[model samples]
Target: MQFLGAINFSLPLLASATETADSSMVLAAVLLSLVVIYLASKVGGELSNRFGLPPVLGELVSGVVVGVSVLHLLVFSEGGTDSNLIITFLQGTAGLSPDAAAGVFAAQSEVISVLAELGVIILLFEIGLESNLKDLMAVGIQASVVAVVGVVVPFTAGTVGLMTLFGIDALPAIFAGAALTATSIGITSKVLSELGRLSSREGQIILGAAVIDDVLGIIVLAVVASLAKDGAVDVSKVVYLIISASGFLLGAIALGNFFNKSFVAIADKLKTRGELVIPAFIFAFVMAYLAAAIQLEAILGAFAAGLVLEETDKRKELQKQVIPIADMLVPIFFVTVGAKTDLGVLNPAIPSNREGLIMATFLILVAIFGKVITGFVVFGQPGINRLAIGVGMIPRGEVGLVFLGIGSSIGILSKPLEAAIIMMVILTTFLAPPLLRIVFPDSEAVGVASELILNTSGTPLAVESPTAINSKSNDAANPEATPDGH
Candidate 1:
């Protein structure tokens, strides 16, 4: 009987050892993923710099190469058998049963979702920080018209095209079109900045339109999310979403304005040495949280916060501190996104329920044409080049990918669909730099606009110069003024 007891105790010990080994294997897989992501990002950054392309384009392409549809370096390797193995290992590490593993996978997917959310937020924040409200205001009217047309036209076209050609469901087609509405300003800004045209009139219009695009995109996303939950489009819910979104925007702007004054006062009072960097971060987080509570994106809040503080004396100091943190955390978000993709899944030989090639091609076309046609909507402006503007809006960057990832996670899109969306993002991003170079060869002469300045009453003001005034007066009073200001 004592010998039997000893055997029972030994059996438990052996089982524990096996469990420990499984945990170790899970940890090893995660570590490998990290290493691969880091290396791929580095290689991409270098190549982009060498090719005079945006670094983000390189990073995204690198991800595609490592993703499921391509080289199969990671993620969906060996026909998704590897992904299943990794998921299984992760499940075992969490002490989950097979049934519980599914739950765990669902929960872990949230982490990726949150990272994607944060990535877009930070990206928008950077765009906001770099934005000049005055410049946006200068082009506000034209830009708003263009932004609306840009969104409406492609959306209508995409909806019609998908329904007519593919006969896909209406909701899915709408969702796909909605996905295309976002203009990744980060890539555009990067390209413009590199070409020394960020301050130009055309650039300013694009930036302003992009800001509006982001706001509209979020509204569309919320509407789509609501429709997905309800299983049909609810006009009442959409109305409510629009009202809430408008309120959120107004509240953000008001709160940011209020906080800007109060925080500046507090910072002035503190007068601590070393630039009071902590306050800016505190402001960023608080505004971000506030925005989230109001059902707006945190990045919008961050951007609003930046916009509010743009004119303050401490603006440079605040940017200097916040940018470093953004720089570090933002790339982790992108690299992780890249790492999650499984390039090997694209193979036609995969015998599964996945719709690989057709879906990918459709998505790619949707992503491309949606932004491309927006260039033609420019009107009443003689010197403005709409083609350059459209090309500038091409890159999907963090925002588009975030939308794709979210749709994928919620079962709105299948894995192959997710891969296809990612391909669209990568291709669009790759096309931006070279296309912009060709379109805006003399980028320096482009005269980029920076910000849209709104008066205290919330009305946008145009920058009228003495030359413009004199020319107008001369045109009315003296024909000679046309040649030289009278």
Candidate 2:
């Protein structure tokens, strides 16, 4: 009996040891995955920047190279039994059996997926920080008109076209159309800043429109995601989503004045490291939790929190501090998005791929034409490079990917449809920067416009004289000048 008791105690210890080893293997697999991801992001991003394209494009291309359609190094279960090279590598090095490796792979993927989700939340928060509510309001009616048109036209046209032309169902078409409505403010704003057009009238309108577009896109995403969950579109859910999204945004802004003060006071009194950022994230996460509780996207709450915090005196420091954290996480979101995408669906040798290729072409055209037309609708601004405004709006960039990721997650998007949307995002993102430079060719005019002062009405007040510019040379640089482009 004493010997039997000893065996029982030893059995529990052996089981605990086995569990610890399994966890260690899982962590090793995850670390290996991150190694691949970070290397791909850096190499891809660097190459993209070298070619005057967005770094995100490079990360995506790298993901494609490392993902299912190519090397299979970063593949997931959704990639359809495509062997993960990481798992194989671990098995060879760590002496794990195939069965054990599979379990490790699943757990590793889940952890990475969670990290990717957090990356997106932080990305939205950073976007909210950069989007100044005051600037959005300051841009006034023209920007509003442009933003509204930019969203309405693409969404309406994409959804209707997909339904009519392809005989696609309503939800998938809506998902695809909703993807079209995003304007990658990050991509567009970078091109504008590089061209020194960021402060220009056309630039302001583009930036303002993009900000509104982000808000609208999130609402649409929440609705579609909710609808996808139920597998049917309910009228009541649609109405509720619109009201909740709008109320969440409006309520956040309404409470901003009070929250800003309390946040600063709390932050200042902490007298510890991360005083400002920790509390900010706590608020953001709580808001994200609340949004999820209300059946909305958690990202919506994160974005709203960023918007409110942008009003605080700590906005600039908070923006600076958020960058390192974003840098660490955001690439995972982007790269994982690329990894899950199966480019095999786009192969023309396969008969079924023909439809996807055709749809992709249609989406590319709609993505470009839809946004370009918004610039022409600027009613009061004469010779405002309506073309430039339109071109600036063309790149869907990371924002489109976010939409694609959510759709893909809910399984609302078919394989072909998903591949097509990815193609549209890639092409639009690639084409926009150079196209923007071409349309806004006169650098001298851009330089002049950069110096022009705008009234509260967003009308160009006057071109500042040379002497007036000289007088302000000693003034401190505008704290808002260098925004986080990501």
Candidate 3:
């Protein structure tokens, strides 16, 4: 009788196990989704590269194609004859009810979203690894003036213009202002390198200002995020934000130096091959997580992590290990961003959506005006091509999209407003190279002037010609495919 009871219990468990294992048709669905997204992203990136645009542009377009806007591979319609057959098939294969199937699909999409967030974290960490803190501090006074003034002018203009004209609220209007404050260091560096002016005095200033711009920009992002999330834009909170952000960054940098020395001491003892790369990434991820825990943006943590690791002896090692990861994952974030953008919102034919176009137009104007004023900010800096410097600050590429995406995801930016920001980012990003070349016609003269630095208030001193950098000047005549498109 006891033996019979044991068999009965075993039978039920076997039946239950079989059903549970067989119900996981979601495994196939997830794999298929990833395959489709990757394939679409690759095709899009290749096309963008061929057209002389950043591969990111193509990735974004591809996401729209494979996403809800077209293919609906990631999202499916409900109770319609023309609904996605894939979802229907998945439901049947998994022996799932309609609600269960929908839940499964939504969960899988969240997996991708989580991965995309990780993708950006890795991207920011890689950027931090590339930035040299000492070089940034070297051009302090001039870069500080340019960066500070550059931020203030554009921020004021964007905020006041949006609130006064568009009737936008103080919160969102401030987000717009903060968005305009970003300058793509990668893009600027690429252009300066292309112009064979990477080491030029002006290039140094541009690069230095960009480093400062990044730090200040993230600090601004942290503050704005607080204002948005906490539902009160208090002055005391803003002041606290500035101090805490500054403290966290400085603390991270100082603490990270000690960590580096300790790691280096143990590097020889390590049996693993990744060496500093692994530890560096661990540090970055931890900081990002901590930032999120503290109600600040994770990107700020990642950026600071990079800054901390900037002093590491393992920079080259970290670069070689981390870049491949970033290159693979970063495009997913961009593509996913593109996928979320409902192009219909900007369609002129859709009367309700036409406001998106107007908003884009206004944003573009302010974005241009805001950064342009920075060229004239540094008092009596002679020998500098102020126009070129201003234009260099114009492309709001990767970082801008990241900020807008975060804000939109967090409910701080509305649908129409998000569409407007996307349009503005796209326009400013693609139009910059041409505008830069036009504004800076005489490269030789600019190159000559670019070599001099202003030491004091009004005195310009000549320096050695900057060493030539390997840039995309090989295709300089073809301005369309400039490598500066971030």
Candidate 4:
């Protein structure tokens, strides 16, 4: 604890000479928090890796250890508009009104949260940049098959089990089942990358299915939320939600692809030598913002941006720039996830929370069986572990969190149900990578720390010269730019 507070090197020179700390001190505090966060992330990841576990799990545990849950380093202050945790550990805020601390609290939490969100966007962007639409399309039908099965089976099981076995309300049960349907591409992709399987056929299939599952999951969430909040789901409202979600993906890709050459030409005319990254980030954030505006996940926009860029030769280089940023930010996101989990609620011995414990156990069991069945959809082939793919899909990742948040905000998902669903997410996430290790005994998941584990399905993303930009411009000028890119 003393070592963590000793990070005074980041303090502003002007603030150090003062008798009092100001907002600059808050800036220093935030920076110090990241310092501590990064250090904890590394230590936890190193320890986890030594034991042959996925470092992601370790990074998450680091969050719990360093965050409000254990370390006393940071804690979320209830009803404060300021920093999320006390910075007395870094610098004292003596003689200030309680309200003055609100700004400090808000600043730290907001900044770190934005960075963590950016981490996931970068992670998805790298995945998209490595991927080709053609490969996603090749397995499109089969992926759709698996996605439909994954959603339906889980939703049915969750709803029925809650209604019959657990005797929960239809609304909460539906939410519980809804939580089960997500495949958490983030977690699955990381494990596949660790195992050196991201480019393999099986990995591609899982990725494809997970993407579709996200779309279906969003639509399901919308319909279910409507049923919970409005007392009836409107068909027109459901149609609009589906169109909005699907249209965001299809429209973003269409607009991005159509204007790709013109945009590249403009950038080349500027002659910045910055290649694909500038345009890559622009499209990613723009599409991500647009997706959120239209009510879909921002990562969806990032992934679509990757697919659009994958068409060009700029992918490998674009991926190269994206991974480092993702690596830094992604760990913080996972750590925050761990830190935010109220470990106190996990105990079943607490008399009041016993119902929650039982419900969570039931949901966890159902969620696993629901996703595990989808892996059985694979064709019989050598080296394709059907069980491994199913286990890979089990982790619910951010998508499950989104569902829980929406349910809570809408006044439907109760405390006990929320606890139950959160437990399912944590358990599924912790259990997936280890299970994958057992299933893939030949996995190269343990080595290659710095490897980006990117998609090998596309061309290298090199900087385009003036001539190439002009050639692309000419191709666009012609009326023959096919949808198929042939």
lDDT of each: 0.57, 0.71, 0.61, 0.67
- Global Cα lDDT for candidate 1: 0.57
Residue range 295-323, candidate 2, lDDT tens digits: 66676678779889989999868876777
Per-candidate TM equals: 0.71, 0.76, 0.70, 0.82
What would you estimate as the lDDT of candidate 2? 0.71
Taking all chains together, the TM-score of candidate 2 against the true structure is 0.76
lDDT of 2 at 264: 95
Ten-residue region with minimum lDDT total, candidate 3: 1-10
Ranking by TM-score: 4, 2, 1, 3
Candidate 3: misplaced stretches above 4 Å?
A: 1-27, 68-70, 74-97, 163-179, 182-232, 375-392, 395-422, 429-466, 469-486
**How much does each candidate deviate from the true structure in C-alpha RMSD?**
12.2, 10.0, 11.7, 10.3
Q: lDDT-based ranking, best first?
A: 2, 4, 3, 1
- Summarize candidate 3's per-residue lDDT along 1-486 as a digit string, tens digits: 000010011334434433444336556665666677688778986676566544545666787787656776654222112244455667777566676655455444445565666766766566565455564555567787888877888788888988899898889889978888887665455444434444455666776677568667766776787788887656665676566656776787678767777766666567777766777778888998876565455766776687677676766556666766766676666566555544455578865457778888888888887777777776545556777777777877656766675687578776667777877776676556556556645443333332332211112222224332223132223222212222
Q: What is candidate 1's lDDT per residue for 1-486, written digit by digit as tens?
A: 000010011334434433444444434544545455557777986687577655555666676666554544445221223344445655566554665443333333333334445654555565565556666666788777767776786667766776787676777677666666777765676556545445456677787777677667766777776776677667775677567656765675566555666777888788566445677656667777876676666666677666666656666556556565555455545554454554454566774314646766776676666676776776765656688878877776556655664565566765555555666665666677778877875432222122222211112212222233224221232222111000
What's the true lDDT of residue 350 in model 1?
73
Best by TM-score: 4
